[model samples]
Target: MSLYGKGFMIWQLARCENGNGVEVARVARAAGLSHVLIKIADGPYTYNVDRTTRVDLVPPVVQELKKNRIQAWGWHYVYGSNPVGEAQIAAQRVNELGLDGYVIDAEVEYKQPGREQAAKAFMAELRKRIPNTPVALCSYRFPVLHPQLPWKAFLDYCDYNMPQVYWQAAHNPADQLRRCVNEFKNLAPYRPIMPTGPVYSAGGWVPTESEMVEFLDAVREHNLSSVNFFAWDYGRKGLIALWNKIAAYPHPIGPQPADIPEQYFSLLNANKPAAIANLYTDDAVHITASKTVQGKEAIQTWHKNFLTNSFPNATFEITSVSGTGSTRSFTWKGVSPSRGKIENGNDTIGLIDGKIAYHYKYFKIT
Candidate 1:
């Protein structure tokens, strides 16, 4: 199915407009949304059946969304630890709810050892039960950052890729969305990416109205068919203005130079100091907080001695990137055994002929 249109994910039906299905539907319709993905199940046995409502809220919620001409899909948070049990419960809930579609919310738990086989088992079981329900895998936005997850295994059987592109601790939704879509497209068994942007605030950080609008704009500009928000409850309560802005944003469709910074981080995470050095010119200079290293050989030695060895398990996650063409700046967070935690690290790179000519790195360890 071609999943196109604006949508919101419903975490708890009971929390929506005081458990009034009609009110919830009215709110969704007012928001100009076309679909609602409701949380139906979590893990093997937990169903989001609100006891206070005294009704199997899924049916009523789905009915209301459908009544408002909004497609209603069910989402299940799969643990992947008990593949068979999780699949059985998810398939049973999907069948019982009679949802228009289903989404598997797989996360870090699925990144454990033997995850590929476990994901296959879950998918196989789910397919055996549903036979023909549209299923999608919803997980991390960056495929490169999560190499352990069984992305191909789950996506191979799924119909769509709904990545949770939550730009947490950052504000550049457009850039992040573009990178998210691009990275997923590079993977095998690629499916249509319908990203879920963050609406709820985390750690005192909430996306602004302008950022939400830019997110929709980026989605449309990328020729992506659909876009969805992370939530409805928090949005309706705290982000009404942002919510309305997104609803009114013109998302009519149509149509990467950041690879060097990306490759630097990737190589750094891989502990390939020599490979990272290769990205720079022979006389490239790397300026740190205390000292500077000039020449490729010196830079390689610095990375091997200070960058890699100092933190064996250190990984740099690019939070945001800015600037035009050759000169670019990026913000990142890193964690390692030696550093413990590094936050708000900034890097400026001057690229010549797609190779780093000069680089400056600054950060604080906490």
Candidate 2:
């Protein structure tokens, strides 16, 4: 059977509530997560030994997770400065702690001179010590963005590719996850991809509960083995509702529908008012901020005037799409010379017989 499970990565053990390992394990199990990845080390010397708790937290966390029948894996960040030292530290920790698996988090520091050789040295030393342990390479989601990082060198020695597919600054989780997996497959050897999504709210942007569900759905649609979120502390404290919703979400059972938002936006961008109107039923109604237009003819006329006269160079971009059955809601943005810029654009489309029967749009122009 496929390893279809939900998991979360913890950046630091001390960050957990009161630095309690049992509490951490209970929270994870309560969230329906089957596994947890805790940071055991950073660089060559900084072990995640909790300062406030004044104890090594990894063993207790692992022990608690094991008691709960949840897999506990350890991860370490490699700075690529002292490859042998980093590898030795990682190997020694893994051996001492006996984790279910290990993850190598290599980032910007690896994208420097002699990076490939450094990665090779690290992986060689790591494998020499723990030859049979399952290891994964976790790094930037898009290989194109970090071409200098020795992706091949590290992945060749690792067992899985755990890309940090944090959909920050954008809400299109399905599209972004799809693109991330496709890009990695094209560049590296085929490996099971267990992508990590975002839960933390930073820079005035936070993901909604619905969007998080859509991300899990996207992972299931791709037939991936597993899905994980970034950090545990932020999620438990800041996004409690979203966290509960994720735990309660049921596993998708069937194939997902074809992506229709792309086509809908395509028609809008093409300035084909008639073609766009044809996507709706003959008895369809369009609702806007200023007025409501009933019947397909009236809707067609309204679109024609806006597309041909008002916003001739308008372009629509969809950030998120969600819903089930016949109702769907999409968040978008429109740019045009006439309107200057349309932000916070939202549309709710109700379908009947595979055609739009009710459409409502709202936006703010600046």
Candidate 3:
């Protein structure tokens, strides 16, 4: 959920290297993309499923992206017709794919009368399934333009807003983008904005390479931590000029971890054992299945050996966390190259004077 830097949306799986997951991941990694939003569900049904073979096409891409250390998010386009069905499909696909984030792409359909209640129902049902997953609302760039899209109903449950600031048939990306940010800030229950810009062409008109630069500059000027493009199928392989322009732009990273638990998990993903051990006090003790280690140096060595020998090139993700004043309990999962998958990782830690004093961990890697 802590998405940062540049990302691109993938609309059609087959269009990109004939739906080869490894190829898609290689493309994303080469572009230095922090995340890739793959289409997961459309209305009440799942997307990216092979019609003839009846096999889900999303998991391969999701697996490949995660292996490359890039966040693979799922996006759904909703019509608010069958809120429950849509919500169920949303939950099913997100859980099945183990997505890093979920995006609700609600558009003009929610603007119709009597759709606000539907939005509420959809979000409530969706939350019941994946309560810990980060969700976002990707809708119109300007809420003022579409006043009846149930923005509050969706935004209340969302962790971020990614407005589609396409600015189609126009060259004023900076002006339009700035205005988009200003408007969203005033909306009720405003979430962190990670606006999406146009990388594809509409009709015969295309966004000039300079216009893309202007848009990125405007996003950086607003100090937003992240930015994304609309479509990979459209511009990434189609238009080299715009793609290169976006590549050179240094999209800023997200803020630091907010808490001790977050910092610890982040260190695990960063694969820095010494830095991770620094979070504990000098006399801290770590309890595990094999042995109990005391002191920072021992703790560091243990983690280093674990990372190197057990799960090399692995990324750990905290699935859920709960805690009190000086104690915390968290569940995590990890994935790595060479088919390493960790599903059940439960840990509890006791903090003393803002530093870890006692840590107990239980996990299985298969």
Which model, 1 or 2, shows the larger lDDT? Answer: 1
User: 1-366, model 2: which lDDT tens digit per residue?
Assistant: 123488888886677765687898888888788788889888997577856765787888888898998888888999999999999989888888888889999999999989999999999999999999989888999888889999888987877788998888888988888888767755644456889888898899998888998998888777666778888878878888777877887654233343455567888889877888888899888999998998878988998898777666899776556564688777787889876787788889999888889999888778
- Global fold similarity of model 3 (TM-score): 0.70
* Global Cα RMSD, each model: 12.9, 15.0, 13.1
Candidate 3 per-residue C-alpha lDDT over 29-123 given as tens digits, one digit per residue, 9 for 90 to 100: 88779999999999998898988998888899999999999999999999998999999999999998999999999998899999999999999
Better of 1 and 2 by TM-score: 1
Per-candidate total of colliding backbone pairs: 1, 0, 0
Report the error of model 3 at residue 75, Å: 0.3
| Candidate scoring better on lDDT of 1 and 3 | 3
Worst 10 residues of 2 by lDDT: 251-260
Against the true structure, what is each candidate's TM-score?
0.68, 0.67, 0.70
Candidate ranking (lDDT, best to worst): 3, 1, 2
List pairs with backbone clashes in candidate 3: none
lDDT of 3: 0.87
Report clash pairs, candidate 2: none
lDDT of 1 by residue, 1-366 (tens): 445678888887677787677887898887777778888888887566766765577777777878887788888898878899999988888878778889999998998999899999999999999889989888999989999999988988998889999989999999999888767755765676789999899899999888888888888776577788888888888888878887787654222122676688888888898998999999999999888999999999988986756656787776656555688787788899766888878899999998999999998878
lDDT of each: 0.83, 0.82, 0.87
Report the Cα lDDT for residue 186, model 2.
56
